[model samples]
Target chain A: MALTFKPLADRVVIEPVAAETKTASGIYIPDSAKEKPQQGKVIAVGKGTKEHDMTVAEGDMVLYGKFSGTELKLDGKDYLIMRETEILGIL
Target chain B: MALTFKPLADRVVIEPVAAETKTASGIYIPDSAKEKPQQGKVIAVGKGTKEHDMTVAEGDMVLYGKFSGTELKLDGKDYLIMRETEILGIL
Candidate 1:
């Protein structure tokens, strides 16, 4: 499915990756202690603000703040919309 | 004393107005119950970003979020430095 929503300003639309339920050492993590996912794939990007240029491109894996972005649902899929500044780095 | 600090981007420096310790009905508010001040006077404004223009001027009374801005101390005075977007309105 295609995303029809367009973000404005420095905002970007992200498709969140599922939170990992297992630790790197093969330990299972319980739901009660699972942290919010902080990684996502860039789906859409806005024409950056005048002072800053867009640095991320579509399909890039990125790291962001755990609590960043507003939740959105489109075409039966979940997404997030937030400013590029909230994205900490491109992975 | 004149302020020598200049903020970059769309940031602004604000001198917070003291929080009222007394209620409008003349009741004294306890320290634990007093809210952080949300009103301040604009001391300096940065050149706005490309997508937006500066709307506030120096010495303008403004309102902002209670948790907005980074705390700053200059010339023995406390101040807040935040982006113009954090400013809710000019009073």
Candidate 2:
């Protein structure tokens, strides 16, 4: 389903990438050891706030803090809603 | 000593109020059960950003999130430095 939800202020909606399940050396990582994913694809962005402009565009891959943003569910898919400042950088 | 530190952007420097050591009924509270103080007096304010103007001023007693802002020390006194957005309200 297409996302019709628009964020407010400088908020953005993001679809998180799954955490890594394997090591570079080919070792399988257990679910208990998997860290929260910090990377995601921007799906929607809010209009810039009075003092700042939106920096990431939809379809941009971005990195954020491990604990940033609020968890959301839309159209049965998991997403994150956070301010643009929460995004560390575009990848 | 007077505070000479100036915050940047929308950041503000605050002097936190000490946590309550007694209940409203005057019962002594233990250290382990004391909540972190979420109130502070604004010490210095930034000139704001390109998109937003600062909403607070020096000497304003404001409420904020318990975990918001960065802990800082200046001239042997503890302080918190945070963006104006982190301030929830002025009291």
Candidate 3:
């Protein structure tokens, strides 16, 4: 529960909840896998830009496209959150 | 290899490559199953605007955050491609 975002304009900042490599299911694939699964926790959300209005909020777990978001480094780790358009859905 | 994009000044259109339910792997979970994987193909790309530039081209398989990109419905199909920032990494 450690997340906060300061979005500029219509860009929403989200702190992706890191997916557990090994869930209760079984051993999760390594990052080396070509077709890997993406998981994350949301931290910050941006205001809607242009014609897009945001429906997601902070602290909401979400799932987005693997190819979405600009890779960002915060607090010496990885985190990503872009425009409301970039976000897919809340988990 | 089937993609065409008509981005509107700073936006890109992508045709998500639908992920195979049953791959060379084992049984793929049903959509009703939580923690599902998202897959799509790139179709269109928008021209750069403001402070962003066009990087990812059409037909390039990409991975994004689950909460990334605005969900769009076009021609009875679903697709999304925003700024280069919206795109996480090329797959």
Candidate 4:
């Protein structure tokens, strides 16, 4: 499935990875205690502005700040719309 | 006074602009109803990483998302530490 919405400027569309429910020590974390997920896969990219070149591309897994981006529901799935700058690094 | 706290990779320091207590029509807005300010002056910028070049400089006024950055008290004043990408535009 593809997104019909296209981002503008330096914005990007990302599908967030799910938060882990279990710890390394085998402790199961409840939903309320789970940390916000900060990793995602890039789904779409905007045309970069003249001064700022776009650095991220489609299908790149990336790390972002905990509170970064606007949340949205598209096609029954959660996504984030954020600037390319909000992406901490490509993994 | 200069801030001794230098930001690291892709981070920036900003001094937020105060929220206006009055509207353009001269209506007074109470503190409880005021929206968070999204504009600020860039106080410092981190050195750019190999893939991302630093674009902001000290003393530039910038726009950021309302929920962006971590708030901190440095030298008895308020400041926000956010990634350079958190900055929306330079003014």
Candidate 5:
């Protein structure tokens, strides 16, 4: 879904992949025990500075650092705002 | 000074610039009140993954986010380990 947010300067808005609700053994994972997901889909990207090139594009799936990015809630949906460098690999 | 630590894959080692001890208006800033410095000089860098290009090099002064990176101490000096993407700009 598209929104009205616009990031600035190599920053990106990412929608994280949801954590697994159940294990392969059919045990329900409690919310407190759910791991933070490290994968996401790029939603928005900022224009890169003159010194740096922006390579990530919208709709790209990416891997990021475990603690990278700031969490935000927009329109009741969660998103992360991080520099493009915080992305480890483009999947 | 050189060290033996080598970072892995898109990570970088940085020596943070010292926080200002005094304000420009002649007010002495105590250690507890010192702001986290957001600038540093790159000391080491990891080889980037095949998808991400490694563009930063040692000795390049850079600006980073206030809360970015992990703190470490080597040879009695402090350093930070962060991905190259945590860097906001190269100075």
Candidate 6:
């Protein structure tokens, strides 16, 4: 399913990758113990403002966070990703 | 305990308010179904960059996120929050 909000100029929509549960000892780590990934998938993209060297687009997964970006929930599923500037790198 | 990294300047350290489990129906919401908070505390801050309007500082809980910021794990505990610019607002 697609998000209703389309990221605007230089922004991108992302769905962060799921976190892992197993610890190094093979113990199941609860969500309380895991850090969110600083990465995600680019769902929609705004034509980057022609201000800097922009290099991301729709469908491109990226690494971000200076850390930056907004979080959004839609259709009962949670997804994120924000301004391309918020994106630290393209993965 | 204070984070080892002291936010250099405008940044403030924050411990995000934990998320609530259970829907309105009181059904437990699994970690897999939850979104990480797009907010955090200022751990270490660089003195606010003088070029723009610097409106944040250490210990001042701010509402940030374009949404933006980084995630870092220290001593096995996870913490987040980034530049004042990344912070959308002060709480």
- Highest lDDT: give the candidate number: 2
RMSD to true structure for each model, in Å: 11.9, 11.7, 14.0, 11.8, 11.9, 13.6
Report how closely model 6 matches the true complex, as a DockQ value.
0.04
The fnat scores of all predictions, in order, read 0.05, 0.05, 0.00, 0.00, 0.00, 0.02
Residue pairs in clash, model 1: A50-B50, A50-B51, A51-B50
Candidate 1, residues B1-91, lDDT tens digits: the string is 5665556557788998755544344533233544443777899887666777899999987878778876654444667778899898877
**What are the per-residue Cα lDDT tens digits for candidate 6 across B1-91?**
6567765554444554343332232222234433433333445556554543344445544334423555667767776756554553332
Candidate 1 clash figure, as a count: 3
How accurately is candidate 2 docked according to DockQ? 0.04
Judge candidate 1 against the unseen true structure and give its global Cα lDDT, from 0 to 1.
0.70
Local error of candidate 4 at residue B56 (angstroms): 0.8
Residues B1-91, candidate 5: write the lDDT tens digits.
Answer: 6778999998999998654432222222123423222556799999887755676789876556678999999899999999877775453
Q: Candidate 4 residues B1-91, lDDT tens each?
A: 9898999998999998754433222322223423332556788889967766677789876556678999989999999999876665443
Per-residue lDDT of A1-91 in model 1, one digit per residue for the tens? 6677889999999998654433232222223423322557899999988767787789876545567999998888889999987664444
Which regions of candidate 6 fall more than 4 Å away from where they truly are?
A21-37, B1-91
Candidate 2 CAPRI category: incorrect
CAPRI quality band, candidate 4: incorrect
Interface RMSD, prediction 2: 14.6
**A1-91, model 6: which lDDT tens digit per residue?**
5434434345566777544434333433234543433656677665444464457766775655524665554335556646677776665
lDDT of 3 by residue, A38-63 (tens): 44556776666765555656665544
Q: List the candidate numbers ranked by TM-score, top first.
A: 4, 5, 1, 2, 3, 6
How much is B26 displaced in model 6, in angstroms?
Answer: 23
Local error of candidate 2 at residue B7 (angstroms): 22
